[model samples]
Target: MTETTPFGIDLELDETVAEGHYSNLAIISHSTSEFIIDFAAVLPGVQKARVKSRIILTPEHAKRLLRSLQENIVRYESNVGKIVIPVPSSPGDTGPKMGQA
Candidate 1:
């Protein structure tokens, strides 16, 4: 067997998406004895907030990953304010109606 890397990545996008500015989303899951990863993205300008990158690992790996993310979050919040989750839909504005444009 070939030497394996610690992490692997792949990407999938719509045919029309531009080559530049393409971001990757990775999803990871595991079975009884193996793990899986899937990378996907939502359409451009479409509910990007709902697209989440999932990472799955065994208990030990999960803990390690959590700690790593926590450290990064601390560093990030030190520079910027605490991250706040934004609410969907702009406030104080009605959405555009169909066939009006």
Candidate 2:
């Protein structure tokens, strides 16, 4: 059974959607009206990476999403441990060198 929100929108999760996609890197670009987020998986030796998903949101909604992510990250770190981002050896260097268009 699904629960309805105060706005009367029923929230339901399908099996496929619940399984979800895995994205290691995210590319974010924005225009005056909206923000575009592209989720991708960059493998160690892969020549090219494909965008798994693209989500567009208004600037206001993007800011709200940022806040929500920050809150969740904080809670996650508290339960687990601090997440670490390793500094790359050089500028423009990640796991693999690939040209993305």
**Residue-wise lDDT of candidate 1 within 13-69, one digit each (tens)?**
555543433224454566775445444554544654332333356766766776998
Query: Given candidate 1, what's the lDDT at residue 95?
Result: 32
Best candidate, TM-score-wise? 2
lDDT, candidates in the order shown: 0.53, 0.82
| Clash pairs, model 1 backbone | none
Candidate 2, position 72, lDDT: 94
Model 2 Cα lDDT, one tens digit per residue, 1-101: 46688889999978777788998778888899999888888887787989888999999999999998999999999999899877797876756322222
Question: Which candidate number has the best lDDT?
Answer: 2
Q: Where in model 1 is the C-alpha error above 4 Å?
A: 1-26, 32-37, 45-57, 90-101
Candidate 1, residue 77: CA error in Å?
Answer: 0.6
